[model samples]
Target chain A: MKYRNPHIPEGINVTKRHPLKELLILLGGALLLIVALSWVFAEFGGGLARLIPFEYEQALVPDALLSSDADSELDVYLTQLSERLQKHMAIPEEIAIKVHFSGDDVFNAFATLGGNVLLYRGLVEQLPHENALSMLLAHEIAHVVHRDPIVGVGRGVGIQIVLSTMLGNPDLNVLGNAGLYTQLYFNRDMERAADAAALGAVHGLYGHVGGAKALFEVIKAERDRMGDGELPAMFSSHPLDQQRLDAIEEMARDNAWAGSGAITPLPAAFADWLKTAALRTESGRNTGNTH
Target chain B: MIELGIFLALLTLGYGFGQYAERRHYRSIIEREKRLNALPAIAARFPPTEPQHHQALVIGSTVISVDYFKRFLAALRNLFGGRVTAYESLLDRARRESSLRMKQQAETLGAEMVFNVKYETASISKGRGNTIGSIEVLAYGTALIRPQAADTDR
Candidate 1:
């Protein structure tokens, strides 16, 4: 009797497929799933979030920096102008708009939950006229009117829950980023709507879209100075400055709205108020008032 | 962003080093298999009485850890619920390498053959929640060494 182990063939127990090839296929499929699922969740979540009462949304604002910009002359001026625009846009009286003017040099403004609007001196200081500044305020106010902040939160939470539940692993930190790309699309849509609504308010308030263009001009200049603005419109939260500029002209032509009008100058003490706001911010920071 | 960067860096390193190590290991395993083939390790309970051979137990064990690249592939496979081909080669290597080592031990004992060869496998990383883990493969058999050869070794 002969007893011998036969020479088994190599690769008999293992598949011959290439690992890298398999990875590419899996990665592509996963990306497709995440993008599709995120969009569905964004729409569903936004719809549900819209049903939330505006009065209750105020609870979501943490540590309300209302004090940071409340007492300053800048805040008073911005609030008064915002009220005038509120009447012009016919914002619901139930929705009380609270404007906070941050003295921080950050070049941005945003509306948060609870009809809270924040304006950084970095941006307001550059506005060439009151009409341009009004456009800026109106844009943020439009976000409040549209209930975008809470909807944004809902959309974000929905996507996070799905991704974490569906693709659970330590490596999720990297893969979960798939949801962010779709979220940008949602953000851009909200921004485009806000821009349209804000443009209408600017025209109604000043009877033209003239100085509104200069608002974007200031933003574009700041973007250029910061060595940015090359990001494509799709990746950006807001439409590209150039794209917004083009859209403004197109809307004006369609509505037969005048392209030129009397530009309202800001108060003569506008620059002085900005300096005072900055001093207030310095003192607040020293006192450990985080805003 | 930093976490993503680190993850990517780890993946690249795992792929590069894991592939290189696998290739070198395969080369060594194939070369040793050829040399060790003269000594057979059979999974049969019975040995021939005519050979009048003495029997002794021999065991070979190997512990192998999964590399990050292959572990990631396996994790992805868990999602799609398909063939976990990424882990197939890893287990195959552990089994074959342990068998080869067992044969080498029999050869050292001047054995004619090894009979009733059996294998055992255990995962050291059990309870660690599906991270990259180490697997242990143990091959054991009875060696049939001639009385004369056994005497000379003693």
Candidate 2:
């Protein structure tokens, strides 16, 4: 009979094979691949970031200053809000949190480039409390801090400028019409960053961040009452629902503000002012429309 | 008077340009409609609603298929309203373009009709000032081939 050798190695196969060396080799290979990919992408990916196509030749002057046509008293209130924001945030002073009024039926607010807050008179009137207003303002300001608009614009590199020229601006009028596209154009990453900044700012300033959620609820309720033809501008820009609400709720819970009181509707005085102003605008609009 | 002559000359010139632009826009719209009508041949068949049994036309993001219908209304409003003419042309263009795209998508999906269709118009600009520019019209709808129950039963 042939000598049958035991089906076992005399020396252990594991001793000569070092796991550390193997891991290093694998990691080195991955790193090389990543670097090579990045290099290739860097060279070829020039304007590919701009997913949308727009015309650049028909460019028009972009307005630096927001149209200021509101009452002086409202202007004063906005000034105070800006001061408060300045003190609360560690961001630069140049980024003033001023309010620009939108004469529309929809209740909404937004942050423009830098720190300017565009507040719709209709939306501001719906705010139940000072904290609610602060929270909204802070949220928009947070968008400014995170440079969301800049990044969003950058991502739409080729088409954004052209769109900007054609659309004039992503203001109440434009956004009011296009909801989903605008949201996607803004990109989800920018939105997430703004959400984080807004939540953080609201907590830091008011010691309670629940106002963001409350604001949405109020908006939804108000929207339901108004019924059709007028969806809140926020819905178009910051599409909200259960998931978004839950995300904010989680953030608020995780960073529960130590001392934020229950946010009530605006103080009677401010409410009165807003109501009076709205009446004026509406009456003016009716008269103008009739004419 | 020379002034009256000048006014007539200016009016004629303005009318000529306006007519030219309008004719051009109309031709573009017609071409778009034609392309959209032929969409079914090129697109993947998609159900109008969810579930395999339902028949629906699928709409893609084409200049012919989907867009805001508001442009026509807005333009009409411009005829008797404020300085809104500035927005009228752009809105109309966006609307027509988007609708064409959506129609193409739907037709491609072999959809006979799209119901509960919503129109959306967005301004993707960096306000009045900023170097970068952007604008886009996106229209989408549930594609349906229709009569899913009858077809499925067959």
Candidate 3:
């Protein structure tokens, strides 16, 4: 009776598939699933959010974030410009556009819920002319009129919720930065539409679309001065500055609107107004009032 | 972005080291299995009574851990519902290693053969939220040793 363990072949229990191949396949599938899910969520959520009454969005606005520099020359000038642009935009009468001048040197301006637009001193201080200033103001108002902020926030929240649920970790913001960057990228289209609408408003107001390019030029110059690490168009909230400049040219030619006209210079007291706003903010911070 | 970087780094390190360690461990396991093959271990309940053999108990146990790479792969697999091949080699190596260790023990006791060989497997969790920290494979059997052979082995 021979009793012995015979040689067993290797690899019967374990597969020999290349780990990297499997990794690639799985990773590709996972990324596709996430991207597809995000797109669907954005579309559905944005559509649903738009259905919410504009009044509801106004009510949802956080009062603390909407504070203006108040009654100063800067505040009055920004509000007047916004109203001027709003007239050209043919915005709804129920919607009121409030422009807030934040004295912080943030080098950015953004429109948010409740028809509230915040312009930072750092960005406005760099504007080369009134036409450019109007362009900036008009672009934000277009967003407000289009109901972008509420819809965008809705899409973002929906994506965040779905991702957290999928990743099995509610605490961890799964794909948080990547998701936010892509969200901004989705806003790129909204920005383009706003840009086009703002151009039309500028042409309507000033009899030409000239110097509307200055807003992007100032932004591009500021971006350059900050130097490098510029986000690609796919990840950014707006098209490339060069692309936008080209888009402006194309729109002007297509509509046969005047491409070249007298460039309107900014108010002579503009710089002083910004400085005064800055001082007001400084004092407010120190006194712990009207922050 | 920083979290993503850290996650990739951990995955790369886990894969590189885990794969190398698994290959080396498999090589050693194969070599040991061949060396211990002379000591037969059987699953049959009864052994032939030949040469008035003596009986003794032999046991071998091995505790093997899953690498981070395999764990991540398994977790991902849970999302999609597929074969968890990442853990296949893990348990395979553990069971084979435990069986070989039992044969080596029986050989030390100068056993002609082992009978009623059995295996036990258990997953040890350290409260790490559904992830198994390690697995233990235990092999035990009765050895039929010749009295003279057992004395000579010592």
Which pairs clash in the backbone of model 3? none
Q: Which 10 residues in a row give candidate 2 chain B its minimum summed lDDT?
A: B64-73
Worst 10 residues of 2 chain A by lDDT: A52-61
Top candidate, metric TM-score:
1
Q: Give the poorly placed runs of model 2, Cα more than 4 Å off.
A: A1-65, A159-186, A223-239, A258-265, A279-291, B1-154
Q: Write model 1 residue lDDT over A65-176, tens digit each, in one string.
A: 4655534566678888998888777587678788888888888898999999888888889999999999999999999999899999989987887688768876445778
Best to worst by lDDT, what's the order?
Answer: 1, 3, 2
Number of clashing residue pairs in every model? 0, 58, 0
Candidate 2 lDDT tens digits, A1-291? 111112333223223333234334443543343334433332233234222222221121133345543566766776677567546766744443456665555567776554456788778777766666776776677766654544444534433333333344222122212322443535544556666666666676666775667666777777678775343434444545454567777777776654346664554577556666667667767786421
Worst 10 residues of 3 chain A by lDDT: A169-178
Report the Cα lDDT for candidate 1. 0.85
Cand 3, B chain, TM: 0.92
Which has the higher lDDT value, candidate number 2 or candidate number 3?
Answer: 3
Q: Is candidate 1 or candidate 3 better by DockQ?
A: 1
Kindly report, for each predicted structure in the order presented, the TM-score of its chain A compared with the true chain A.
Answer: 0.93, 0.59, 0.93
DockQ of 1: 0.61
Candidate 2 B-chain TM-score: 0.48
B79-100: candidate 2 lDDT, tens digit per residue: 2343333334444556566666
Global Cα lDDT for candidate 2: 0.51
